[model samples]
Target: MSPQRLRDDLVKQTKIDVLTADQAKDNEAHMHTVSRSFLTDTITVPTPEMMSYAALSSLGDAVYHEAATDALEKHMARLTGKEAALFLPSGTMSNQIAIRTHLTQPPHSIVCDARTHIHKYEAGGAAFHSQAAVIPIHPANGHHITLEEIIHNADLTSDIHFALTKLIVLENTLNGTIFPQDEILRIAKFAKENDLKLHLDGARIWHVAAELAIPLEELVSPFDSVSICFSKGLGAPIGTCLMGPAAFINKARWLRKLFGGGMRQTGFLSASAAYAVSNNFEKLFHVHELTRRIEKGLIELGAEILSPAETCMVFYDPAPLGLEYAEILERAAKLPDPITLGGSRLVCHIQTSDQAVADFLALISQLKEEKKAEGWVPPEKTHVNGNGVIRDVYVRPKAIH
Candidate 1:
């Protein structure tokens, strides 16, 4: 289907009236109990009937090793136009396996936008796995690296006195804008000429593919390797896939095992992943439209919306800080506190609806309109203990002045 059509139809919205008042209340009540950390992404576990084809594949725990991997390999290879593909436990593992396989040449380096997930998160696994330097390029605002930026930094004079840029990675729908094909093509051409491997961190590749109206295969064929996560917007509970030449995939499989990713019967996760790829993806395109709705809603309220919501993420910095960060942190740290859901760092996903959006807006509105006469009790109100100051007594809840 055309990306535009998919976007229009896949996220086809149900009218607010279709939901009974009780159902709406139930959803909000559910959200109250749900942890905000889990709400930060679209990867909530599915319900029992969420596309589970028990008749076709009843072995819940079976990883469908031969079948699932074969399906995964074929799916990835067809999508990437690569010779082979393999599955890993997580996107982290998938990217790690690919990097380890390609960075065989010592002193090899990867060039990426500094805002990449691999750099910020993952707890430094790249160094432990590959022992290679990851050179940071123009990494900002989700760090999208451009072609000219590459040509400007690349060493055409000689390979020595520089980390051989073995890999160049680009993320799509990066900071909510898909890279124009010309840019991707230019980088691919640059990589080819410089003997560099082009890897695509296509965790959310569907957004780019759906936005550009290009089949993923056509868009990703130039990449030497690609890592796609099923658990992100794809809505799967777990699993990630890496695509590349058959030889490269064979090497990745072995490394996956070495990383303790080899599972006895992971079909449970794979099954869930397969179901997510087919059914959940249609919902992702709709998120784009929903984001537009939120952006417009926030803007109309006279709030300075930081930037328009493109995909599922929309961040807005609240003004005149209704509450301090430290207070929010301390309050949030209290175990089982439902107020954490009201954190400034809001996120949206499939479970969220228009009414829920309204409630969140209302919550934020209430938070901002109120005033406080004082901050948290200073150390002056507390007594010093051996290692820490102790509150002498509970400071009465400051009345909203």
Candidate 2:
């Protein structure tokens, strides 16, 4: 089937409702979103409330100024205990700038976990922009990468045949599991001993810090460079900061301009980030509590959780429930307090409320009871590829976008 047709079939089978104009307006107030990284869909574009807050700000910056952008950079620098920081347009830009800045010479490589954002989600931008190859270390448990594993993959020899490894990139809260503190310290020592620059893909570092009750600065003090997204879990609309040494940030600033990340009058966005750093950072602990509530409820309803809830993300396998993916989503959408399920991964953010989570748990409980009464048979695994090919492939929840 064509891709569009497959989407149509999935929507139809799932009974996904497209809201009309009036319904959409009502949804603005009552809809419960369980699978988003940001505060809400309304926050994607600035709402009137956001605008009002942004309007209560000072004048904007031209290229670089000391008011908003400078304050934000300084705030992040202090939070991460780095010498300097630069605000970039997106996490991708921040991460790539760090990669390119670290690997100054060609034929350099970066060692990271196999499922890292740079390895899996950055669209090969590391190689495209930095001309660096990535050596991904796949963990046996498929959660956290140990220092031993990282050392096993490290190739620091100055051989002409192999690409020189210049950096070791680590991701905290990779798929909601915090990289252990001792492991992180061990890796940092290893990187220093091996003459490898350590970079942290700390897109969700806020979540990790909150989970461990560790201050952000202490958490990221080991790495040479760190990329953090204010937009994700921090409730900022759009902004990411690359924090590192003064010289490293100076190089990254030039690269940011080259990559079209330099922006004018960005105080409007930075002001929001500043607000989030002060306001929303503490709320992540509560969000994780809500996530655990959902996870515990789901397990009671016979859902097989794929991983333990660590921060704001939960992964589960729904295949054992004897239901197709589309059907599972259909039941979820048809609930009285309807939910918009995103495959098998459910994420909680600042806006995910206790009542919303309770409603979702109720919906799952209802489905489980219905399934027991119906004696439904397990269906063959039906999967759709990116190109719309139908195959008997099992679907797993994807990492946070």
Candidate 3:
């Protein structure tokens, strides 16, 4: 089926009520969104109070300004213990810029886990922008790559036949589990020994540091460059920061412009990112706790917990309960305040409340019980059948690059 036709079928079959941001805000009490990675509509959309604050703050200039853009960069650099930082439009840009900056000249390669955002989700951007190849290593558990795996894939031999391994990239909270610090340190040591640059896709690093109860700087110390998302788990509407050495960041700035990421009067956005750094950073712990609560509820419902609840994400397979993906999704759409299926991943963030979690679980329980009573058999072939049993859902709001 065509994409638009499929969407039409879903809406018609489920009678799902899709709400705009304004509509969601108006219906906040009824809305329960467990799949969003940041604050829900109520917090994400600016309020009159927020507008008033922004009015008092310094306005951004046509070019990157000292007060807003520069200050945010410096603040992120300080927090991550890097010599410099550059604020970019998105995490993808930051990661790609780091790739371009590190690889410099082509015929280069970057080694990363098969599931890293750069390899899986970024639309082959490293190849397109940096003219570099990606060497993906799949870990047995599908969560994180081991140091041994990196060693196996590094392929640092000086053979002209192979792309020179210029960088090793790792991700924190790759599948909602914190990438172990010892492993990171080992990889860093190996990268140093082999003269390869190290970059970290720390998009949700805030959750990792909060869960580890460690300072953010400590977690980022091993990598030569780190990209952090203010928009994910941090509750900022948009913005990502890339931190590294001063010279590296200077090059990244030029790359950002080349990538068309330079924005004039961006302080409005930077101010929100600044707000997230100061205010929302610490609230990540509570979000993780809520995720744990949701995980426990799903466990009680006989859903398979695919991974341990570490940060604000919960991954699971709902098939064990004999529930059809379509049926569950359709049921969700029928709720008083409907929630669309977020693939298979449920993510909790600042706006997801304890009550929202409870309500979601209750809905699941109701579906399971109804299925049991009716002896309902899922259709032999359904929309999600070919997609695999395990669902990996990460909520990132769509934003312009």
The C-alpha lDDT values of all candidates are: 0.64, 0.79, 0.79
Please give each candidate's TM-score. 0.74, 0.84, 0.83
Task: Give per-residue CA lDDT, model 2, range 133-206, as digits (tens).
Answer: 89999997678888888877777788898888889999887877788888889999989998899999898899
Give me the overall lDDT of model 2. 0.79
Best-performing candidate as measured by lDDT: 2
Candidate with more favorable, higher lDDT: 2 or 3: 2
Task: In model 3, state the lDDT of residue 83.
Answer: 98
Which ten contiguous residues of candidate 2 have the minimum total lDDT?
A: 35-44
Order of models, best TM-score first: 2, 3, 1
lDDT digits (tens) for residues 38-88 of candidate 3: 222123444344445555666666255647778888888999899999988
- CA lDDT for candidate 3: 0.79
Local error of candidate 1 at residue 175 (angstroms):
4.7
Q: Model 2 reaches what TM-score against the true structure?
A: 0.84
For residues 232-343, write the lDDT of model 1, one tens digit per residue.
7776767788999888888887887788887665555666777877777777667677666666665664344444575766655443333443454454445453333433
**Angstrom error at residue 66, model 1:** 2.8
Residue pairs with colliding backbones in model 2 are none
Cand. 1 TM to true fold: 0.74
